[model samples]
Target: MIEAQGLTKRYGRKAAVSGLDFRVEPGRVTGFLGPNGAGKSTTMRMILGLDLPTSGTVTVNGRRYQGTVWPLHQIGALLDARAVHPGRSAYNHLHSLAAANGIPRSRVEAVLDQVGLTPVARKRAGGFSLGMAQRLGIAGALLGDPGILLFDEPVNGLDPDGILWIRTLMRSLAAEGRTVLVSSHLMSEMALTADHLLVIGQGRLLADTPLNELIARDAANRVEVRAVDHHRLADDLRTLGGDITLKPDGTLLVTGLDSASVGELAAARGHVLHQLRDVTSSLEDAYFRLTENSVVYRTPVPA
Candidate 1:
């Protein structure tokens, strides 16, 4: 398990992360989410001991990452897929990491094959495509078979097949009781992959909860209704404090009201209901609601 207590980091006059306290327990995938410039990269760097925190602490297991001997055997990370040497072959790169971490040379071949890079193991990393490079980087992370893994945008530049492969891989790893922390911007994928989430904005911990809870908390309660007398039903709902929106297809989108209440109201008003059901919000919807104010860079909507 990974834990942080009052973790903070600053750069000159700017604070990157402030008083972050959370635990990434084993046996599940924890998604690290935040908007751009929200200090996600900075926090991850501090967790890996790549940067010193201005105050407090973050530890892998019970110890600091920098103080651990044979660090790869305890925690493996893929923060940057392009951090490899351009001139070295994929096989050589893994071999070098294995040698330094006291991992067996045989393990290098195993991970290379595991990542499906055995066919192009001899190719220079500089020439590998983005997807291939991501695979190679994953191979290095698995070289030690650590119990804890951190993947930052592992699906970036991957094809659909590669994306599915990593998703399955992370889930299986968690099934084996290993700790997995994934950071990505793809909410659709995160909805399917993560069991829990750690959301931050402006370097402050905004949410640390289960996936379902986060969705339920931020997603607005909305109900979709289709009826013969859409106009009458909408007007009636509005009078009862329901926020209503009339769609182009003549459907009534009702908010601040539940499906049963809307149905009962329509029935009492003698309106013929065609369809009445709750509109489920996607992860994207909840994420937008949660991070609306946290967004640093906004694209102005066209008038």
Candidate 2:
């Protein structure tokens, strides 16, 4: 497990992270989400001891990560996939990291096979594609079989199949009772892969809860209805003072009302209903609603 209490960081006059107090427990995939410049990367660096916190503390398994005798064995991270030396072969890269950390050569081969890099083990990293480099980085992280894992944008350069493979691997790791923290901008992928969420904005904790709970709380549940008397139904729905948009496919998307309410309104109007279903919000929708104000930089759409 990973724990942080009053964690903070500052660069000159600007605060990068402030009082980020949260605990990431084992046996779960916790997604770290934030808008651009919201300090997600900085917070991860602090957890791995790459950046020292100006105040408070962060610990892995109740101890400082850097203070551990074998830091790699206690915590493994894939913050940057391309940080490897380009001159080294994939095998040589893993071998060097393992050697420096007292890991055996057999483990290096095992990790190579695990990440599907066995075929390119002897190939120079500089010639590898982005997807291949990502796999190699993951192999290095798994070299020590650490209980705590941190991955930053693991699917950045992956194809569809590769993305699916990564999702399964992360879920399996969490199933093994390990603490997994993933930082990604892919909201849809996170919705499927993560069980919990840690959302930050401007270096402050905005939310720390289960994925479903956040969706339920922030995302409005709308009801979709279709009937022969669409016009009358739309009029009745509009009386509820909710935003209604008619789809090109002839379906009415009604918000600010639940399924039960929509059904009752239809019944009250004595209109025949062909379809009345609740449409829950997607992860992207909830994320936008929660972080709408937290966005640091905004880009205007072209007319």
Each candidate's clash count:
0, 0
Q: Model 2: clashing residue pairs?
A: none
Clashes of 1: 0
Tens digits of lDDT, candidate 1, 205-268: 9889999987876545589999998999999999989999999999998989889899899989
**Per-residue CA lDDT of candidate 2, range 183-258, in tens?**
9999999999999999999999999999999988754557788988888889889997766889887789988888
Error of 2 at 196 (Å): 1.0
For model 2, what is the alpha-carbon lDDT of residue 219?
Answer: 48
Prediction 1 TM-score vs. true? 0.91
Residue 220, candidate 2: C-alpha displacement in angstroms: 4.9
Candidate 1 residue runs with Cα over 4 Å from true position: 216-220, 227-239, 269-274
What's model 2's lDDT at 230?
85
